[model samples]
Target chain A: MDVSNLGLIDFHAAYAIQERLVAQVASGEAPETLLLLEHPPVYTIGSGGSEANVLDPAISVVRTNRGGDVTWHGPGQLVGYPVIDLGRRGRDLHRYLRFLEELSIRVAGEFGVAARRVPGKTGIWTDRGKLASIGVGVRRWVAMHGFALNVAPDLEPFARINPCGMAGCPVTSLAREADAEPTVAEVAARVECLFPHLLNELLPCETETEGGRHVCCRLQVARGKAPLDVR
Target chain B: MATEITMPKLSDTMTEGRLISWKKGVGEQVNRGDIIAEVETDKANMELEAFTSGVLLETRVTPGELVPVGTVIGIVGAAGEAVAAAPVAVVPEPAVTETAAAAETAPAPAPEEPPPVHLSVAGEEAVKASPAVRRLARELGIDLQTVQGTGPDGRVLQEDLERLGGAGVTVAEPAAQPAVAETAPVAGTEPAAPRTELHDALPLSRMRSAIAQNVSTSWRTTPHFSVTVEIVMDAAAEVVRELREGGTPVSYNDLIVKACAMALFRFPQLNNSFAGDGIRMNADVNIGVAVGLPEGLLIPVVRECQRLSLREIAAESRRLAERARTGSISQQEISGGTFTISNLGMYGVDEFASIILPPQAAILAVGAVADRPVVRDGSVVAAKTMRATLSADHRIVDGLYVAQFLGEVKRLLENPVLMLV
Candidate 1:
């Protein structure tokens, strides 16, 4: 899978980028891609989710065609949109979503965060609360609209929503558990760094990685230092 | 009327703070200047005070919960007010102000009609796992509906797939010879069934989790550079042997600690930490000796290493490590380390660099000291020597400074009398 760090893009622009990349990858023009970026204060509702899930009446949102409930995304949150072609991997959508959640759980494990799957739930959770939300859309076996991890965001935007239509639990981030607050870029670097190895172990696409099982590429995601460019 | 008292943001970066303890309880008279509760922020523990003079109506937050600032943690209003359904006053986040401003320009678009849902019937009932799990099952050709779940509410955990090949009867039934050889183990001739009966998931202990998190964060964030040097331990070993013979029972580790203390005194710059904001040079020379345990490694720090003699350092080191191994070492016993020395000498490790512990600028990874043939003064002789690698955070200690510090340590270890004196 190709990973690109699109740091700090607006919601509309990122959505447009995903749309463009999804079409490209679906048609075999562009490589199967994972776009990592952060959007400004915005609430999003999937096709079937209720707008009422956006608790704050004034909260602005952009409707998208993805599977899940309403959720908020902002700065300090790492949003990964993987336009992966599952034609050769597997045609099952649930398995693909599980891979995304497992990938997230493994990354959180690196940070000493015990991120787990809540059995019937479709996201990642910690002892404190929900740590991540996974919602995706597919086109002819090409998956897009990936997962979002709360890194060190203001978290106030989360308070304005029920957080993926879940209730009675708080939303937590890595910074809250971390001794020193981590920046969005630092987390993005780790996600890009660890995701490949995890994908290799958890779900290896034989045609993609060749003989190399370990994706040990370390990235420095500070503005200009990161391997992947921010667009 | 009961007014909700919410969690207050103590700092700019603090999105949430844990309620350490409540100074007052329900129905207690809370006045201005009254420290109603103590909240622990990322930086420090702060006092949460009451602004209005009223009775503590209710405590919405319990101790140890890290809630967002302005969450309705308590109610401070009139006496006996019916707070049956306490209104959870949502603490407006600073980011919400930006969202609200954006709302005016683009008012929330009216609720759109729900899109048409497409439910796939392919393996619908058989797909009894999360999206990630189902895909892996399909890839491995293991049916999920056949696998027993170990997760909450009979949910198929990620680990259930491990037993899919053996325990799963239906999936493996069609694979040529069937699972008949696996089921009808011919009287102790089954090679003990490969010890793969049950699938188990081991949860991480708190200490293990802490070690993983701290080291991972440090390794990722810190820019480290290591310098290795071979130091002759003939003199230090003689001193240690002499001490053990004298009934003090000191080890090479104690001598190294003392030598490090003296070396740090000589080169104070290497003892400083790279705090990201600025370099902090520690006043007292405290050396943390890394003690390996089953759970993980614990570094118990020796305070005032400069004042303690060889015997005292040895005694204290033994006491602390013994306590740590026996699970008696408290947090205070293991904290506040300036520099660390990790010895893999006992394990026969030759020489390896280690990750620099966070907030501490440098750490010394000590290797085994044994009889090795070496060229001494041009002639090869069997000499007792130990190799050490010092990994220093480049953000704090300069290469020249670390080299000088390591040089001094080598000199002190070689002489062995200067530090003791």
Candidate 2:
């Protein structure tokens, strides 16, 4: 995972970075990149989104190609845009999404938040509503646009639109969930740091297993250790 | 024209779905019959396909966010033209507004319901606590179901309960209590609060959940009944002992598989699956031997068990079972089993009932061969006895037929030489 932190960047600028990185990755010009940053306030809807979801027409709404209904990306939220070539991997998009979710869940667990999967729902959830939202697009099997986990974000803009196209769906933050206000960088660093570790857990390393398959994957990162305070 | 791609109904029970991931990017050319996305429904993860040949336009829904069925998730249209024909207006500037910032101070998402305190589980007779706390509390003669936990999800912590009150509050007389025993909550109560605790949990793997879904469906729909027979294994045990002693190692389970295959002839109902249209009697008496793995249970069938001699039966079953354990067993090996045998005899389990695999009519649960007293002629004498249970799908297998089939198995096993031939 080639991860870059473009701290507190403009939404369109970050999107350009994503596009550039995606093209580079697809062309084998650069390695897969995971771009993490906080976007200034913006309401983005997909092409399939209904205008009815955008309550306040004045809010800067960028129509994106990413999957999902309208969503809010602002200062406190850490938006991760992974410009990764999926063809080199299994090219299984659903499994890739589940890996992203598992990464978020593990990151939440580091902060003592009991995040879980709701049966039919997409996002990582606590008893509180969704804690994060994920949307991505792929071209030639190269993925772009990723997850947005609420860190210390102002969730008020979420009320302007039916977030995730569902009315009255409550969005939560890492700080709110953990009851400690950690910076978006800290959460972003944590999720970025834990991403590959969690990815290998779900996707598995089949090539290594080929040598001797009978032995179970006998490795675990020691738990109950303090999360590295990368803030 | 850019056409909207809405959420497709993945299953009968599906009301909502999570877009797991998108396979197509904006401006990516996609043809009809190409899979464009994967959505997770209540039952399983289903593949979503592109219905029209076009370039992917825009996706409206993000992965991990749940939306209802028929919610438009993406659009597809002619590539360069679609980019010009905007679906929705991109507002120039999102107003950083007044009411929005104030809305933060408005109220936190419905001031979350205060977390609940843990309560005692009554009639369980055992304290609802962790093994560590439950043991510690019992050593102090304290009832676990009596304490309220302050820990996460109301789980009783040892430190919290230890600081409750007086130490070693003996509920039972020391003379009456046995040493190092799992204390059951007795009738009389010197109870304070019931002990409640929670343990860590991991999400069930897809394999585990699939096993759960399949077996649960089998359990709910099938009407099941079990019949037991204790065959005095004096002769059968001798046959096994002789085989081991003769350097050809074979197990009692192997002998039983052979016996069951022979019994299939006497009772053909055991070898047939009940199709809704009619009973499909399989020509081959392929026996499925249940193999337990760390992840889940698998049944590998040893085909044409009746044709194989006792020695051949032993080798084939072990090979199939070993492959099943190593996770290399093929689809053909796992399927077409007309009968199944689940043995916990090695674990010292006696006469345990088992569930029948779907479509197949019967499963034999074999128990340990033990030395017990049985009447021979007039007086009760010490003899080796083994219990075998037949859990049959009652829709097809009648009780009397099950009895006759079990009787035949007993005769075949007790006359141990019959299986060798």
Winner by lDDT: 1
Give stretches of model 2 more than 4 Å off: A1-231, B1-22, B25-35, B38-201
Report the error of model 2 at residue A110, Å: 67
Q: RMSD in Å for candidate 1, one decimal? A: 22.4
Tens-digit lDDT track of model 1 for B1-421:
3444555443223345566668898899988557787654421334444545678867776775655544556667667554433221232111111122322333223111111111234744544566655544443334565677887767675567544321122232332322444654567755664432211223345476567667987899889999999999999989888878988888999988998899899888777776546666677788999999998989999988989998999999999999999997865567768899999999999899998888788899999998898897999999899999999988877889888988988999999998777
- Tens-digit lDDT string for candidate 2 (A69-178): 68898898888887766554434556566666777787888877878654235667775778988776766557788888888888778988878766577788888889
lDDT of 1 at B297: 87
Q: Please report how far candidate 2 places residue B350 from its true position, in Å.
A: 1.4
lDDT of 1 by residue, A22-75 (tens): 779868799778899998777887655667677777777777767667888888
lDDT against the true structure, per candidate, is 0.69, 0.68
Model 2 lDDT per residue over B119-191, tens place: 2346214434555454344322345555666777666677655554212222222222123223435455676
